[model samples]
Structure formats: structure tokens, C-alpha cells
Target chain A: MDKQMLRDTSRRISPYIHNTPIFTSHLLDDMTGAKLFFKCENFQKMGAFKMRGAVNAVLQLTKEERERGVVTHSSGNFAQALSLAAKNLDVPAYIVMPNNAPKVKKDAVVGYGGIITACEPNINAREEAAAKIVAKKGATFVHPSNDLNVILGNATVGMELLNAHPNLDMIVAPVGGGGLIAGTALSSHVFGKNCKVIGGEPLVADDAYRSLESGQIETNYSTNTVADGLRTQLGDINFPIIQQYVDHIIRVEEVEIIQAMKLLWERLKIVIEPSSAVAFAAVLKNKDYFKDKRVGIILSGGNVDLETIRFS
Target chain B: MDKQMLRDTSRRISPYIHNTPIFTSHLLDDMTGAKLFFKCENFQKMGAFKMRGAVNAVLQLTKEERERGVVTHSSGNFAQALSLAAKNLDVPAYIVMPNNAPKVKKDAVVGYGGIITACEPNINAREEAAAKIVAKKGATFVHPSNDLNVILGNATVGMELLNAHPNLDMIVAPVGGGGLIAGTALSSHVFGKNCKVIGGEPLVADDAYRSLESGQIETNYSTNTVADGLRTQLGDINFPIIQQYVDHIIRVEEVEIIQAMKLLWERLKIVIEPSSAVAFAAVLKNKDYFKDKRVGIILSGGNVDLETIRFS
Candidate 1:
């Protein structure tokens, strides 16, 4: 996507999403020896950056497509994001969630007006359930992170960060399904003055890191990280953009992820999920390189299950 | 004090404190059926509004008093607040704490340059320890929430809130040692246009509520509340102000406090201490009176032991 397209997508979804605030802490700056600016998407509508992409994707649909409604398979923040986005736009949303998904997640989606269709807790079952909805109900299937429109929408986060602090030396984001970092990299390349983009991945789920090194998409053998959002592999739509613009990937251990998450909660006084802490963990892990530089970290979401948090 | 004094305190502490942002949630507003504005003192420099009073008190100290240093007896956010405030002003801070205070609390004081003197957990022992420090060092004693200068300092919170939202029909603050509510009441009286002030107290530790009815300071026989910060009884210095200016006080159950705290963490995406939640719980408890009116709630602090949090 071009710069104009990113700008247009941001404007299109402006009314539906929040221009999330950037938070800074002197204690954190002293600890890490870097000027850290946290772009808090935790405060975004539906409590995640996914809302930006979801709203833009739905808005880009034609009248007929909008009339047919939308469908997505997710048990994470994207389910709530798409459901709320569709509800706001007066369009129906069908969510395909695994039956094993937490009750809180299912309840949140339903609370946002999403029509749920539960399937087995497997990729094949999820995809099959979503496909059936698209076939029977004439619904538009919207990929959470792989679609071009969704990537363009996520790009607005980086664009807004640069607009607020134009001289940031680097921007770091967690490499989840690769959509957020890819869009961030594209935004930095187009909207910033030499702002480099980096991706933070869980060492256990380092598909994006391996893919970059192998010059092709890679898959994870196991998803055993606390950063649950970063377990998914990269897709073709955003992988090329990430390869072209992303500076490099840094992998952090689960322990480091928890430490960073605790620090953010203690110092910044904001609630953030473990996945969002990966970006900050990467900076702390390699403090020598990031020290003395203005670094921007995207706190992707704050949809943690408070009941099950295990800081130990 | 008056409006000019409140304005002067705001100006004096402006350099040393954060003019913390106000947060709003559509979900919370919808849930309460009122327009709610949260004065986020949880984001204050020391993670509590105590910093505002601490800095102001230290700044107002005479040159001789400052040279001799400052001292206070506390086992909560005030220990860290005074330590950081004194450190910022290049003055020594001596903190007298119960020997049973949490290790994290002691570490925070030390981290902020406060010299700690441990004493028995009883109030008489705390007073004796603090008195010894005063006699030995000839330092100025700064009460955590009972001194005039400190009350003036805390009043800036309400002053700033009024300045931001002039039309607020009422403001709610949790009553602890009574400095915050007394100062908030004064600010609403002086700065607001017919605005009323309310106090939220834990039902188990409802000394402030009882004091208002008895026309004399009252003490809690049992401090069996989860809101640890509000267990202290109202002091003579702030009791008169609270009685004269505060419209009323609302006492909430411990379960209500936890529920409100959860809503803030889940919806507003901010970490607030249980004491802060008392005010929001008060608003929720009396929704009929507050409905359709503009209400402001002061989020008192964010200093919870993450390791020991038991939501159930």
C-alpha cells in the first residue's frame, strides 16, 4: 500500500477509533537508558489496535458487501474489535471461536454484538466454520491480519506515532501475525525521516525471525510462549513489506517478557497484556544498542485475563 | 485555604509534579448513567496523589527546616512520596515505618533516597519513633495528610479537575486520613460554580462517615477493609474542613470496592489501588442521585503488590 492509501484509511477509520496516547516514564528511561515512548493502544476502542484495522477493512467494503456482513475466526482481541467495528457501522458480524476459548473471550464478543459459531479448537475447524458462514450467509471473510486493507489500517498507528514524535530513531512492535509490524515498517518508511522499524518475537514462537533469515515464510513447531498473540505465522500479503522495510527481529525469553510486563504496569501504570510487553522486552534485552536513542514501542493491546495472570 | 492559595500551590508544585491526565470511559459512563471524569492521580509521579502534597510541603519548608531535612511516619505511598519529593528538593527525608511494612514498600522508600527507621506496628510506637527522629535531627515533621501545607498541596488535584471540567456537578474522593477529601471540598467550594464535594469511605473503616454524623472525629474499631489506604482515622487538622464543606459521605462494602477496581482495570485499562476504587464504588452505589450529572472521581494511587492480588 502507498502513503496516500494509509492516510486515507486512517481518515476513514478516524471516527471509529481512538488516536491513542503516548506515555513516557523517567524511571523507565533511567532503567533502560533510552527515551521510551509507549504508544498505548490499550486505551483504543475495544482495548486493542485491531480495532483500527477492523474498522478500515469494514469501511472499505462496497455497499453490497457491507449488506452481506463480515466473518472472522479469532478467539482474541480481533473478535471483539471486528464485532464492535461492525456494530458501529450497522453491519452484522459472525465470529468463529473455538469451543475451548475462555468464557471471558466468548462473552466479550457476544457483548459486542458478534454472532458466535463455535468449532473445535484447531485451525482446520476454525477455517472450516468461517468458510461455511461465508458460503451460506454470503458474508465477506475478513482476515484479521493478512489482508492488505487491514495492514494499511494498522499502519495508522505508526503514522500517528511519527506525527507525535517525528524524530524517533526507531519503532519496535511485536511480531504476531506480522500485520502490525509490517504496517508499522511501511508507515516508518513512508512517513518518517529515517525511522527504522524492528520486530520483537517470543523466542519460542520465532517464526517471523526465522522467516526473515530464510528469505521465506516459516512456521512454528510449538506455541509455548506467554505472548499468545505472537504465535501465528506470517502471511504473503504483509511478509514482503516486512522483509523490505523491517530492520531486524529480536527474540526474548518468556521470563524477560513477564519482567517487562511488570515494569510497564508498575512504572507506566497502564494495563497491558504479555504480548504487548515483548516490544519493550526486546529493548531491555539489547540495551546497549537502544541506549541513547529515542525509541517508540507499540503496546499492542491490554486484553489480559486478570484472573489467570501468573507473574511468577 | 482559598482559591489563590490553591492556585499558588499548583504553580509551586508544577515543576516537581505531573499535571496528570483525566481519563474517560464510554462503558463506565454508560454503566453509571453519568458523565464521568477520572482525575488519574494513579499516574502521579510517585504513583499516587500523595506526591502533590509531599512536593508542596517540602517546597514550603523554611531554609532552616529544609537544611535540617523532613521526616514523617507512614507505611504507604507517603513514605515514597516524601522521599522522592525531598530528594527532588535536595533535602533529606527520614521515614518512620512499622517494622511489619511490606518489603516492597521499604525498598521503594530506599530507592527514592529516604532513610527508614523501623518501629513497632502500633500507632503509639510509630509516634514515639517519629518523635525521636525530630528530637535527634531537629527536622521539620510533615504529616502525611494532616498538615495545612500538605492539605493545600492535595487541594491542587481538585483545583486541576475543576479547571479541566468547570461544569462538573459533583466530585467524589476517597476519605483516608481526611486530607484529600477536606482539600477537595475546599477546592470545590472556592473554584467550582456551585459544585458539591462527596467522600467515599470503606464501610468497615468508615471513621470519616461517622465523624460527620457525630460532629466530632471518630475512630474505626476494626480496620477490616481491603482498602488499606483508608483505614486511618480523620485528623483534627482536616476534620473541620471536611465537616464544613463536604456535602456528604458514602460508605461502600469491600466487595463493591473490588468490583469497581476490576471495572477500572478491565475497561479504563489503568491500574488503581483499592482505595481509589472506593470513590467510583460510591458513585455506583448511589447512581440515582448522580445519574445524568457530571461527576469527577479521583483515582488515588497505583501501588498494589501484584504478587499478592487475590481478585476473588
Candidate 2:
């Protein structure tokens, strides 16, 4: 909630997470007419920024709670993040996933030493199963992106970026469940000098965009986005922070997201998921606003299936 | 050829090239049974270590020669490397490529501002065409991997690697016309403390291994390897260097190259061409010799067509 908490969160999570590199490309700069700094959280442990939040949440638990372990309902990067973070901290992790989740995703969670509990493929089922784990095992339950502790942890990325590039005019991130962007917004608000925050989301799953317009949380009826990470809607814990600190959200077309993802792979030569590409796509789509400006993009993750990457 | 020349080359090329990061992976260490330090030249300017050699070669030319400019015959990373290096040094570049070279390759050269001179798609014809340009225009010729100046430049990767981790037991590089490995061997001989150099070549095009065995530069009857950049035979200038200083050459199968390349893309989350994978593949293939040894692998390049990356 305060600058001191953000600083302490970073210090606490520093040993458990990577202070990922900030990369710049002259060719990308020439194309967008802006000096862009990419904070590559894709290179983070377990290949996502989610590791920061997972480690913070697990570390914040009481000794008794830590002994009991942690539980989270996730079928994406957060599952692997929590598992790895818990493994690093010498704590057990119970990951509850939908029954229909991909085997590859489940295998990665298991690979990271997570104990998997499969539930029916529904939000209610997932929460109920996680609650059962909490009740039976006395484990702590951590939300993927809605916990205050997790948001504080995610804010460290922005702190590091602003520390590296203090004069950045703007910081941009993809809006998924709003954890990253909300934390980014908080970091920029307190630590950045004259810096604004923006977020990019897929048009197919623009709940965050509509939420800002309507001044309330919104949901997508159909989660048909290629950016699988952004299909979830914002939660109460992070929505207010986004509303208060975020400047705006831009909605990009699916085609645009694919094009940006390809450019990242082809030009920057870094593997980034579609979710990470949304932020860069937003900058490319709205070049007029960002022309000749210094912008920082948080590449949120790099956990996509490489075999399925499409260039055309 | 000397330490002074290596130091001077570093100073001259530092402004024009990147001192790329060295990355390590615990999973890779476990897989190879060795502690590995990867010098990521794939992140170099123009997306390969070729930039180092190209820039060094261009800078070594006299001012009058710079005015007349540099020429090289190729259709790979060197073509783009030379063009970009020439542009950086304010020198004209004459790129003589076989007419049958891929359009995408030619486009990349032109994109870097190289003057295109189409030649017959044969070694003799390509050389004759480049020779005619050298005679008619008085342009200085730079071989892709056979010149001493370029070898000195490539040696800087080993110098930097050893500078970072001075106690490396071995340095490994993929043998492509023998420049990178030859330079690596020279670096270990001059600067390394008890460090040996090894070369990784495709079993399909294992001319370097054969040359070492035969005590003569051997050519591949069929260049059928996916490691396209490594298909050429070592020239007289670099073959002797390899023979003298290199400890041994490890030849890997095409399947092993693909496996290592996939591991790099999947676990390391970085783009690397099959050629670069040869070095890692060699490490993976020869586990007993490298087990528990501190080894440094120079990721040679990252210029691969994304449309065709495969793991099978």
C-alpha cells in the first residue's frame, strides 16, 4: 500500500526471483518511432513474472502456515510459478486444476514439484476444491493475481524498470487478471517521475478495457483470445488499484497480436507468449501517441507452445 | 594473432557490437553433468557473432580500402553481417551471392544496404565474380571465416568468456569453416589458464573431424546437414590453427542437433540456429568427458528461419 511495502516486498522476493534484463532494439525503435525498453520477465524463473508474486505470497505466510504449505487454483504460468517458488522456499504446493486442462500444463506443474488436485472444469469447482484443501490441510490459499501481497510482489518489476530507466515517459503492460498492470501502475505512481501507465488487452477478451470505461469490473462472455493468459476478468483486490493508477487500456485485434508476437520472435530474437505481445502490439497500434517518447514494456511471460507459433 | 591485437580488436569493435550476456541453466547442467556458461552471441548485433568478425575485418582495412569498401561472397549470416558492419563503418559493401540463394536471404542483405552482385550458384563462379569486383572496383576482399583478422575478432568471445569465468576447464564452439573454433582455440592458448578448446561439427558434414584425423583439410562430399552455416570446409588459414590448438572435435548427428536446438528454445527460451546448437549438442553427446567440468559454450548465431524450426 505504501512505497516502503513495495521496497520491502522487492527485498524479500529478490532472492527468490530474477531481476530480469531490460533490452532495446534499434530496428524496433525505428519502426515505432519510439525508444522502447523491454523488461524481459519472460526470462524469469519458471518463465513468467508470476514467479515474483508466488514467492512473495508464500514468504508472507506464518511459520505454521508455511509448514501446512500453500494452495492455488491455476492452469497457466501461475501454477508453475507457485510450484517453483514453493520448491525454492522449502514449502509444499498444492495446485488445483480443471480436469480438462492440458496434460502439458499439468506435467509442468508436477515437474516443478506441485501436488495436483483435479476438479471439474469450472470456476466454482476450482474455488471449492482449493477451499477444501485449505480446510483439510490448513494450507494458505493464494489468488493468482488478486491478492494484495501478490500485487506488491509484481510491483517490483516496475520498480526495477524505473530504476534502470528513470526518465521513462510511460510504462505499458498487458491487462490479464490485472495483477501485473495494477502492480505496475502502483510502482510507476510512487517511484516514477512524470510517468504514466497504460495496459493492452486482446479485443476478444477486453473486460479490463470495458471495466475502466464503465468504472466497474466487467467480464468476457466468450474467452476466445489467442492470448490465453488474458482471458480472466479482474478481481476486487486489484481492480481499484488499476482504476486509480492506470491511464487507459488499448484493445488490439487478434491479427495484430499474432503480428507483434512474430516480430518479437523474428526481430528481438526472444521467445515471448501472445500475452506479452499485447503490450507491444498496443504501442504499435497507437504509434501516434507514443511517437518519439520513451516507453517501457513489461514482457509478462514466455510460456507459449512453440510448436504452434504462426508467422503468417 | 597477438594479445595486443585481440585487445585492440575488442576496443575497435566494442562500439559497433554488443557484449552479450552469459546465461546458465540448472536443468542444462543436470542434463550435461557439467557446469556450463553460455556466451549468448545469438543476441549480438545482426543476431549473430558474425557481426564481431565482420566489424573487425572492415575496421582492419586501410582508409583508402575503406573508401573503396569491402566485399564477401555468401548467402547466410555473413552477408547480413558484412552489410551491417560496412554500414556501421561508413564503408560500401559489395555482396556477391549465388543467383539461387533464397530471396529472403538476399532481401536481408539489401535491407542492410549491401550492393548485390548476383553470381552463378557455384563456388568457382562465386569466387570469380567476387574476384572480378575486387579487381575492377579495388574493393578489399574479406573471407567469411578464413581471414586472420576475422579469427582475431571471433576470439574475443572466448576472451570475454574467460574474463568472466577465468577457471573454465574447456571452451566449446561449433566449427563452421573453422573460424569460430580456431579463434576459440587461439584464445584458450593465449589467455586461458589450463583451458582446452573443442569444436562441434555435424556428423553429416564432419570435415573438421576428418581433417584432424587425416592431417589435411578435408572437404565434405555431401553437405547434407541442417547446420547450414557449418557446411563449408575449413580453409588453409584456419585449418592449421584448429589442428594446432583444438583439443578435439565432437561430431553430432542431425537428430542430436535438433534435440539440443529444441532444448535451447524450450528451456533457455532463446532463439538459436541449428549451427549454434551444434556446440551444445556436442556437450550433451559427450557427457563423460565434460561431467562436472566447468565448460563455456559460445552460442555461435541465431539466424534461422522461424517457419521451419522443428524438434522431431
Candidate 3:
């Protein structure tokens, strides 16, 4: 897609999404020796940037398709995002969540007006459940990250970031299902003057980092991470865009992610999930590379389980 | 003291303080049945509204007095605020802390360019330590909340709130040593258009409430409450102002404070100390009184010890 398409997608989803604010801290700037501008997608509708893509994808449906409604399988932020987006547009959303998914997750989906169909606790079970809904109900299936429409919708983040701070030398985001970073990469490539896009991934889930290094999509089997959102691997639709326009991917240890998250909670006073902290952790890890440079970091979401938060 | 003084304080501390943004959560509004506007002083400099008073007090000093520097006795947000404010003004800040004070609190004062003086763990000891500094080093002792300059400094919060949302039917704030609420009352009375000012106090340490009822300064012998920052009693400097302008004071139970704090962390997605939550808790407790009204709540600070934070 081109810059115009990204702009159009932004305008199309403008009514449904929030143009989240950019916050800066002089204390953080002094400590890092870099000018940092944080695009707070954590403050977005449904408390995640996924709303942008979900709203855009839902709005792109045909009149007949809209009537039939949308279907997706996610137990995380996307579940809530799609549910809310569909609710906003008066479209029915069918969510296929694993039976073992936390009750809170299920409640959140239901709270956002989503119809949840429980399946066995696995990716295969989730996909099968979603497929049945699509086949039986004629619901349009929307991939959480591997869809073109979702990427175009997610690109609005880059458009807003660049439009607000055009002099940013680099834009950094966490790699979660490769949607946000890929869309940001495409948007920056089209709209940026000299801005480079980078992705941050947990060392535990270094699929995106390995994918960039091997010049192909990569998969991970490990799910042991505080950044639960980044456990998802790169997809065929997003991998090529990432490989082409993204500068590099930085992998941070689990401790670094938690530490960055705590610092954000302590300093910025905003609640951000571990996934959002990964991008800031990457910036801290690469202090020499980012020193004295103006950098824009996307705080991807704030949908955290507060009871489970640990500072150690 | 007046609108012009409040305006001058706002301008004088403009360089040192943040004109903290006002945040609204539609979900919260829907739940509370009130159009709630949160003046997020939790995001202010030094992580509290204390910065407004601290900076204003420091800037109000004569050039010679500034050269002598400032001193305060506290183990809370004010200690950090005064130190940071003094540092920003190129003045030395002497902080007198109880020897039993947490190492973290001591470290924060030192981190903000304050010279720390350890004393016995009591109010008399803290005052004596600060008095010694004044006698020996010619430092001006800045009260955390009781002094006229600090009250005028805090009045800026009301000025900004009213300036941003002039149509607010009522403004609610927490009463801690009567600085914030008193100043807020003065500001709303001077600058607001028929706006009423209200104070929220903890039932456990309901000195302000009793003082309002008896028309005398009351003391709290037991500080067995979660809102650590609001344990102090109202002083002569601010009590009279509060008595005259503040419409009423609402006292909330400890359970309500914790519940309000959790809701803010969960829904508003911002970290606020228990003292800050008291105001919102009061609002929740008085839902019948506040329903369908345009209310502004000052989130006083975000300086909680995260490890000790327990929802239950």
C-alpha cells in the first residue's frame, strides 16, 4: 500500500479510534541522552493499538459482509479490540477463545459485546472454532495480524507519530504478530523524511529478530515471557514488509522488559503492559546507537493484568 | 489569596511546573453517572501537585533568601518536591527526615539535590532538625502545606482546572494538611463561574471533617490509614481559608480508598497514591449527590510504594 492508502485508512478509522497522545519526560531524556517521544497507544480505545487495525478492517467490509459480521480467534488485546471496533460499527463479532483462557479475558470480550465460542486450549482448536463460525454463520474471517486491511489500519500509528514529530530519526515498536511494526515500517517508508523503523522483541520470543537475520519468517516454540503479547510469530503477509523496510530488530531479556516496565510505571506514571516496555527496553539496550538522536517509541498497549504485576 | 495572585503564581511556576493535562474516561463517567474530569497532578513534576506549591514558594523568596536556600521537614512527596524545586532555582534544599523513614524516601531526597538531615522519628524531632538548619545556615523553612506562599502556589491547580473546564459545576480535591483543598477553594471562588469546591478526607484520619464540624483544628492520634500523604492535620495558615471557601468535606472509609485506587489503576490506567484516590472515593461514595453533574477531581499524586500495594 502507498502513503495515500494509509492516509485514507487513517481517515476511515478516525471516527472509531483515538489519536493517542505523545508524552515526553525530560528526566528520561537526560538519563538516556536521547530525545524520546512516546506515542501512547496504551490510551487508545480498548487500551491497545489493535483497535486501529480492527476498526479499519471492519469498516472495509462489503455491505453484505458487514451484515454477516466478523470473526477472529484471540484471547488477548485483539479480542477486545475487534469486539469493541465491531460494536462501534454495529457489526457482530464472533470471538473463538480457548477454553483455558482466563475468565477475565472471556469477560472482557463479552463486556465489549463479543460472542465467544469456547474451544480446546490450542491454536488448532481456536482456528477450527473460528472456521465453524465463518462457515456456519457466513462471518468474514479477519486474521489478527496477517491481513492487508489490518496492516493499513495499524499504519495510522506511524502516520500520526510522523505527522506530530516529523524530525524523529527513528521509530521503534514491539514485534507482536508482526502487525504493528510491519505497518509502521510501511508507513514510515512512505511518509518519513529520514526516519528509520526498528522492532523490539523479547529474547525468549526472538522470532522476528531471527526472521530479519535469516531473511525469512521464523517461528518460536517458547512461550515463557512476561511479554505475553510478543509470543506470536511473524506471518507470511507481514514478514516481507518487515524485511524490506524495517532497519533491524533488537531482542531484550525478560528482566530488561520488566525493569523497563517498572521504570515507565514509576517515571511516566502510566500503566503499560510488558509488550510496550520491550520497545523502551530496546532503546535502553542500544543507548549508544540512539544517543543524542530524536527517537519515537510506540507504547503499544496498556491491557495489563495488574494483580499479576511483579517488580522483582 | 486572589485571582491575580493565582495567575501570577501560575506564570511564575510555569517554567518549573507542568500544566498537567486533564483526562476523562467515558467508561468512568458512565459508571459514576457524572461527567468526571480528572486533573492528573499525578503526572505533574515530582509526581504530585506538591510541585506547584514547592516551586511557587521557592520562587516567591527574596533574592537574598533564595541565596540562603530553603528547608522542609517531611518524608513524603513534599520532601522531593521542595528539593527538586530548589534545585531548579539554583538554591540549596535541606531536607530533615526521621531516622526511621524508609531508605527509598531518603534516597529520593538525595537524588533531587537535597542535603539530608536525619532526626528522631517524630514531628517535634523533624521540626527541631529543620529549625537547626534555619538557625545555623540561614535557610528558610518552607512548610509542606501550612504556609501562605505554599497555599498560593497550590491555588494554581485550581486556576488551571477552572481555566480549562470553566463550566465545571463542582471541583473536588483531597485535604492533606489543608493545602490543596484550601488553595483550590480560594482559586475556584475567585476564578470559577459558580463553581463549588469540595474536600475529601479519610474517615480514619478525619481531622479535617471534625475540624469543619467543630470549627476548630482537630488532631488525629492514630494514623492507621492507607493514605499516608494525608495523615497531617489542617494548620492555622490554611484552615481559615478552607473554613471560609470550601463547601463541604466528605470522609471515606479505608476500604473505599483502596477500591478507588484500584479502579483508577485499572480503568484510568494511571498510578495514583491512596491519598489521590480519596477524592475519587469520596465522589463514588456521594454518587447520588454528584450524579449528572460536571465534576473535576484532582489526582493529587502517584507516589505509592508499589511493593506494598495490595488490593485486598
The TM-score obtained for chain B by all candidates, in the order given, is: 0.99, 0.98, 0.98
Arranged by lDDT with the best first, the candidates are 1, 2, 3
Per-residue alpha-carbon lDDT of model 1 for A204-235, expressed as tens digits? 99999999999999999788999988878899
Report the C-alpha lDDT of model 3 over B1-312, residue by residue, as the tens digit.
566777888899999888999999998999899999999999999899999999989998899999999999999999999999999989999999989899989999999999999999988998889989999989999999999889988998988999999999999999879999988998999998899999999998989889989999999867788999999879999999999999999999999999999889888888899999999999999999999999999999998888787664
Mind giving the per-residue lDDT tens digits that candidate 2 earns over A230-293? 9888999899999999999999999999999888888888888999999999999999999999
Could you tally the backbone clashes for each prediction? 0, 0, 0
Q: Quote the positional error of residue A228 for candidate 1 in Å.
A: 1.9
Give the winner by DockQ.
1
Question: How well is each residue in A99-157 modelled by candidate 3, as lDDT tens digits?
Answer: 89999899999999999999998888888899999999999999889998998899999
Regions of candidate 3 where Cα sits further than 4 Å from its true position: none
Model 3 clash pairs are: none
- Per-candidate TM-scores read 0.98, 0.98, 0.98
The most accurate candidate by lDDT is 1
What is model 1's native contact fraction?
0.63
Cα error, residue A312 of model 3, in Å, equals 3.5
lDDT of 3: 0.92
Better of 1 and 2 by DockQ: 1
Cα miss at B256, model 3 (Å)? 1.3
Please give, for residues B104-155, the per-residue lDDT of candidate 2 as tens digits.
Answer: 8999999999999999888999999999999999999999999998898898
Query: Which lDDT tens digits does candidate 1 get at residues B229-261?
Result: 888889999999998999999999999999999
